[model samples]
Target: MKIVVAGGTGFLGRHISRALLDAGHDVTVLGRSPDKVSAIPQLRGATATKGDVTDPGTLSGRLEGAEAVVQAVQFPNHPIELPRKNLTYDRYDRQGTINLLSEAERSGVGRFVYISGAGADAASEKTWYRAKGLAERALIGSGIDHAIVRPSWAYGPEDRALNRFVQIARFSPVLPQPGAAPQRIQPVYVGDVARSVARVFERAAWNDVYEVGSREVMTMNEVVHTLLDVMGKKRAVLPIPSGLLKMATAPLKALPTPPMTPQGIEFATQDGLVDITKMVQVLGVEPLSLREGLTRYIER
Candidate 1:
C-alpha cells in the first residue's frame, strides 16, 4: 500500500511514518517543511513532499497517486495573543482538514484517517474542540472512506504536550498544578499511536473512529511526580488557583503558542481518559502503559 501522511514531520507524524514503513508499505510524508522530513531516517526511505494543507493548490500534486491519506497537521506556533474567539482554528484545523479531504477524494484514496484529540466537540464554545469537531464532520460528510482516531495526551521523546510541564519543573523549584491535581488522564505512548495507525491500515478499518490511550488512568500530580521521580529530582508541587495561573499567563499571550492559554488550561485540568476498547478490538495490538513509556526517555 502506498500511504501519504500529511504533517509527517511532526512529533506524532514522524512516528506514524516509521510504523507505516516498517509494515512494508510505501510511505510519503507531505508537510510544510520538507527539510524536517529529510531528517527522519524512516522518512528518508519514504518520499517527502513540501506542501501546505491550508493552501490546497500547493498540495494538489502531493496527494496524487496515494492509496491512503492521513491528516496529522496542527497549527502549533500560531499567535497565542489572538483570543480563542479570534484564533485561526477555522482556517487551520477546520478548513485545512477539508482541503486535505477534498484532495484525497479527488485522488481516489481508499482511506482517509483524521488524527483528532479526545473530547472534541462540534457544538462546544471552545475553539480548539469546536474546530476539531468541525473537521470530523467535514470528513464524515466528504463521502470519502474515512476514520477518525482521537488520542488522549500523547507523549514521547519529541512530544510538546507534557514537555512544557517538564521544562517548568526543570527550572522552578516548585511546579504549579491546576486545581486539586487529581484530574486524571490516560497518556498514550506515541509508539502505540504509530503502531495503531499502521494496524488500522493493515486491517482495512474504514469509516470508524477509535480512541487510543494507555491502560493507566493517572492524576495530573502523579504524572508530574513520575517524571520528577524518573529524572531523580525533587520538585515541590504547588496547587495554584486556576484563576491565578490564568491571570499570570495572560500577559504572555503576545507570544506564539502561549504556555498557558485559557483554553489550554481548561484542557489540562479536565480528565482526558478515552475508551480504548474500540482501538484494542480493531487494531488488535496492546498499547504500552504510561510507566512503560516514560521509562524510555525519562533520564535518571
Candidate 2:
C-alpha cells in the first residue's frame, strides 16, 4: 500500500507514519515542514514531501500516487489559536480537510482517514469540536472509503498536553491543575493511536468511525496524580478555581505566543471521555491505561 500522512512531522503524525512504514506500506509524509523527518530517526525510510493542506494549490500533486490519505494535521500553537495568522481550528481542521478531500478526489485516492478529537459535533458552538465534526462530514460525503478515528486526550513523551504537568512535577512538590472542574478524560497512549490508524488499512471492511481511548476514565486531578505516582513523585494536586484562572490568563492573550489563553483554559477543562469498545472490536487495539502509558512514557 502507498500512503500519505499529512502533518507527518507532527507529534501524532510522525508516529502514524512510522507505524504505516512498519506495516510494510510505502509511506510518504506530507507536511508544511516535511524536512523535519531528517531529524526523526523513526521516519528514516519514509519519503517526506513539503505541502500544506490549508492551501489546495499546495496539495494538488502531493497525493498523486497515494493509495490512502490520512489527514492528521493540526494548526500551530494548538488550543491557543493565532487568529492573526489564520491558525484557528476552522482553518486547519475544517477547511484544510475539505482541501485534502478535493485533492484526494483528483488523485483518485482509495481511502481517507481523519484524526478527529472526541466530542466532535458539527452543530456544536465550540470551534474545535465543530471543526473536526465538519471535517468528518466532508470525508463521509466525499464518496471516498473513509474512516474517522477520534482519540481522547492523546499523550506521550513528546506530546504537549500531559508533559506540561510532568514538567511541573519535575520541580515543584505541588502540581497545579489549571481548573477545578471535574473534567473527565480518557488519556490514550500515542502509540496505540498510531497502531489503530495503521490497522484501519488492515481490516477487510472499513467502519465509518472509531473513537479510541483508554478504558480507564479519570478526572483532571486524578490524571495528574496518576502521572505523579508513576514518576515516584509525591506532588499534591491543587486545582485552581476556574474563575480566578480565567481572569489571570485572559490578559495574557494579548501577548504574542501567549503561554496560556482563555481558550487554552477552556480546552484544559473540557471533558473528553469516549467509549473505546468500537476501537477494541474493530481495530483490535485496547489502549493502555493512563498509569500503564505513563510507565512507558517515563521509562523512555
Candidate 3:
C-alpha cells in the first residue's frame, strides 16, 4: 500500500510512519519542511514531500497515487498560542484536515486515518478538542474508509509533555504542579499509538473511532512524582493554586514563544483518562504503563 502521512515529521507521526514502513508499505511524509524528515530516525525510509495542509493549493498532486492518507498534522504550539501565519486550530486541524480529505477524495484514496485527541467532542468548549471533533466528523462523512484513533496523553523520549516536566525537574529543587485537584490521565506510549494506527490500516477498520491509552490512570501529582523517581531525583512538589499560576503567565502569551500559558495550564490540569478496551480488543495492543513507559526514556 502507498501511504501518505501528513505531518509525518512530528513525534507521533514519525513513529506511525516507521510502523507502516516496517509493515512493508510505501510511505511518503507530507509536511512543510521536508528537510526535517531526516531528523527523525524513524522517518528515514519515508519519502519526504513539502506541502502545507493549511493551503489547499499546496496539497494538490501530493495525494495522487496514494492508497491511504493519514491526517496527523497539528499546530505545533497547540493550546498555548496561535501558530505563525495566523494558523489556529480551526485553520490547521479542522480546515487543514478538510483540505487533505478533499485532495485525498479527489485522488480516490481508499483509506483515511485521522489522529484525534482524547476527550474530543464537536460540542466541547475547548478549541483543540472541538476542532478535532469537527475533523473526525468530516473524515467519517467523506465517503472513504476512515479510522479515527483518539490517543490519550502520549509520551515518549521526544514528547513535549512529560519531557518538559523532566527538564524542569533537572534544574529546579522543587517542582511546581498546577493545582491541588487530582488531574487524572492515562499516558500512552508513542510506540503503542503507532502500532495501533498500523493495525487500523492493516485491518481496514473503517468509520470507527478507537481510544488508545494505557491501563493505569494517574493524577497530575502522581505523574510528576513518578517522573522524578524515574529521573533518580527527589524534588518537593508544590501544588500551587491554578489561578495564581495563570495570573503569572498571562503576560507571557504576548511573547512569540512563551514557555507556558494559562490555556496550557488548564489543559495540563484537566483529566485525560481514556478507556483502552477497544484499543486492545480491536488493535490487539496493550499499551505500556506510565512507569514502564517513563523508564524507557528516563535513566534510573
User: Candidates' TM-scores?
Assistant: 0.91, 0.97, 0.95
Which lDDT value does model 2 have at 29? Answer: 90
Alpha-carbon shift of residue 149 in model 3 (angstroms): 0.7
RMSD of each candidate relative to the true structure:
2.4, 1.2, 1.5
- Expressed as tens digits, the lDDT of each residue in 127-246 for candidate 2 is 999999999999888888999999999998789988988888899988888888788889999999999998999883464789989998899899888888888888788899777888
Candidate 3 residues 122-219, lDDT tens each?
Answer: 88998888988999999888888999999988899888778877888999998878888888889899999999999997777778889988898888
Considering lDDT, which of the candidate structures 2 and 3 is the better prediction for this target?
2
Model 2's TM-score against the true structure: 0.97
Give the TM-score (vs. native) of candidate 3: 0.95
Show where candidate 1 strays beyond 4 Å.
78-87, 168-172, 178-181, 254-260
What is the C-alpha local distance difference test score of each model? Answer: 0.82, 0.88, 0.88
lDDT of 2: 0.88
Off by over 4 Å in 3: 83-85
Order by lDDT, highest first: 2, 3, 1
